[model samples]
Target: MGLGFGFKGRIVACAMSSLLATIAAPVWAAADIVIGQVAPLTGVIAGTGDEYVAGAHAYFAHVNAKGGVNGRKIRVVVKDDGYKPDQTLALTKEMIAQDNPVALFGFVGTANVLSLVKNKVLSDAGIALLAPYTGSLDLREPMNPNIFHIRASYTDETAKMVEHLHTIGIRKFAVMYQDDAFGKSGLAGAESALAKLGLKAVATGSYDRTKPEEVGAAIKAIEPASPEAIIMVSVNKASSAFIKQLRAAGSRAQLYSISVVNFKELLKNAGEEIVRGVGIAQVMPFPYTPATPVVREFQGLMQQYAPGKVISYASMESFVAAKVLVEALRRAGPEPTREKVLAALEAVRDYDVGGFKIGFGPNNRIGSRFVDITVIGRDGKLLK
Candidate 1:
């Protein structure tokens, strides 16, 4: 038998109580700064979501250890939405009513975040959401003052990938995307980028987000074109399945993915041999290389805080985003409000977080437009 309504209600109540307790406890006496995060903590994409939150927490730990911003420690109250938009909206509303987080951070999916924006939750509550994980161009359109983006858009990532492929004389293109808001957003971006170069995808494929294993339809759609390369706008599980199936079908098209796919998860799901030679457009600095000061700092902090966790692009992006948020908090003064934080974020212009540069303006919500392409090498390692 399935869980009854009463049982389900009890579960939800328990979750809400636990979330409240986490925020209320650990009294710093100076009153710790609270931030809320609603993402997929338990679902197909939970691994990536966990790493993102872990990365933000690692940075917050670093900041708190250094006395925090204005002598107040930062604490994040996290709630799991399980990659469901309705759950994201509900959890966010509950967080706002109970915990009263000054800002929302590190939300995972395009549909999940869009639910909040479309319903006027951010504007109605007047809370700023910083560094949501999705790069969909939809978020940037019309410029919601309550939401701030820290990474490059999907458009930027696709343009960079397509432009690089064009330079190498690989003109015939195809796209395989997840069939949802996130997927469609990336597909649109890829098409737009190709159109700018006087070209279009030779083929396109889309698989259901919930039924990633059922990719025969997608394969059938894209196989006939026999394009030289394919841009994949999907997360780990679906992408891995597609790669395995495509390879089994004897397709030799070079595969590329966006930054949203967790490299470690892809390696784990698809194995080193299957994921080998796949290119991915990165929105953040390479974490393993330590070529940049920020990357080195991130590596050191990950060691100190999240000892056993493997450094990854998702974590690196979150770490950098947390740093930007903290910087903005510092500028928001000792007694910070949501409006003050938003103003502080807008005031940031060409601010350097070690080596990585981020800038934002009242008219420009995007903090960075940096995109670099990388490939999977031997032993499931990324080659720059």
Candidate 2:
């Protein structure tokens, strides 16, 4: 079992530059709290995981610069899981035995988390998993005390989009989803939402998450339905490829995606022209819009620490996760422990991270239920 650090060293370096005894003294006097993250640093969904890790890094860096949480700086240790559940399971075990971090933070993928959960990895190790990237009902159902989620669930995102699409007079819905737990969760949500309105997807297709080339087969399934619009639940590459192929095949079906797809990466792969007017359900406030106070802080911190990084919803969601984690740490006080951090997180309620709010309690770990919908405009920006 071996371990590596991602954003911790830089945060400490930034903290030390102050040289003021108050800030510098903490480096020596305070205990450093280490947290582990398992994400896909490579593979098709790589961009989503990479961007989110950068966001968490940016926010943690900002907190460390301001003297950290209760004087103890946070160290985020990251390992690449390659977006594979098996890899996520392996890395998580290594993280527990090797790194022994206080908690598992910002882990990506529904299938990955489910693998960890199903095998009793976190519960067996007695460590909390905080702010997982994917929001599956599987994580929240039966209430696993060790897991805390910051963003809205796939249910929330899909339900909102399906309802919005229905409200806009588009009745015939088609779905193209990845063949995995994440995609199934989104599909379930879409079905539930549509059921509430006495509607259903006219056509649906599933593709393997690991194979972008397989998206062509799913498109073949969706095109024959001739639905008015299609709801997609996939990663950046597969979904981007799906949209490009669907367009090339002369289908005018409106494109809609769940929040898990990174629009920035989608734009890069599929281009603005193909993705223009594509609807996406988002769980975080748009980073480009400074109207939300949290967006301003996130953007400022990203610029300072992750220079030249594109402000993306993926990063913004992780920023929220990092901010909430720091707040929980601060509330846990100076001599923080795994139990204390979990207790503090549970005790959190109506805590404001700038304009947005996060809530948790003894019986609840659902941080926020906020979800929004946006469309990619012709100008290469998300429009509300």
Candidate 3:
């Protein structure tokens, strides 16, 4: 009986010790799924980048509130490269090393994106890049496998604009462009699209990308041509200065621009009367009304996640991109690696996010070609 009692005491003591140790152990929560972005959060085009990142965050926030993707919350880690190419490359490498991000999203400039491609940043890291803001053809063609473009290319946007102008019998075209890879890409597209219709730009003008106000040379070249239409392949600041000066120079040509120019900014900077009737290409759907289910959801999420923020096409594009990224993450299964996400992205075919259709494959990376045109009406509002 004594031996039995001693054995029982030993067993009880062992059990108690085990239980105490288990109770004392720290409970560690699951780590967040980190995504990274390098964009111009400061500089000339800073507003566009801020809107883009905010849109992505709004979607991610919505997803996180619903328990996130596969039980892991998504977190975006961002670094500002200030729209500089060298800084973009360096910061991207830094992000990859520090954050171990599954993918990168919403890089803002043409030169910046091209720098990433040229240096094989995405390929070397074996990561995917989603929805870079610029639409340069160089990024699209020769198909870098690591990059997945969500928005239409500059080539596509320019083709739509040129084709529309030609269809309306508006000949005698003039071209005004920013002196950079972005501007040159748009110029080439405009020229190519015009060539297909047997038309050519009667005059072409260019301004330094950094100094948008120094458009004296471009104006001198283009204004005197007396073209019926002018395709302004530049961003908001440069375009605003050019339009104001061109009008001041007594040129009455109808102005058209690529998707990069924010119409609201134009209205604010150049005034409603000066910007009235300016045609701008749009890659995303209208963000104001519930024209599509995707847009409706975007509006709700924006209000919920980021209340009182101005809704613009730039932000909407990033929002669409975030939704697509979430879908890819879902398809990648519970534990997603960079490789799995890339495969999932490639496998996406006609996947509808609410109402917008996104399709991709092994050979095709550009997700959507849905381009529309909106004009700044006399009242400083975008009109269809």
Q: Which candidate wins on TM-score?
A: 3
List runs of model 1 lying over 4 Å from the truth. 1-28
Tens digits of per-residue lDDT, candidate 2, 1-384, equal 346435887678667776666664645677678889999998877787888899999989888888888777888889998888999999899888987787779988899999998999988887888889887898888889999988898889888888888888989998888888888888898888889999988888989877865687888889988989898988888888899999999999988998887777778889999999899988888788799789999988999999977578888888988888888888878887788888888888998988989998888989889999989987787788
Per-model C-alpha lDDT, please?
Answer: 0.90, 0.86, 0.89
TM-score-based ranking, best first?
3, 1, 2
Candidate achieving the largest lDDT: 1
lDDT of 1 by residue, 230-325 (tens): 999998888988898998888999999999987777788888998899999999988888899999989999999988775888889889989999
Cα deviation of 279 in candidate 3 (Å)?
A: 0.3
- On lDDT, who's better, 1 or 3? 1
Candidate 2 clashing pairs, residues 3+ apart or interchain: none
Q: How are the candidates ranked when ordered by lDDT, highest leading?
A: 1, 3, 2
Candidate closer to the true structure by TM-score (higher is better), 1 or 2:
1
The parts of candidate 3 lying over 4 Å away from their true place are: 1-28
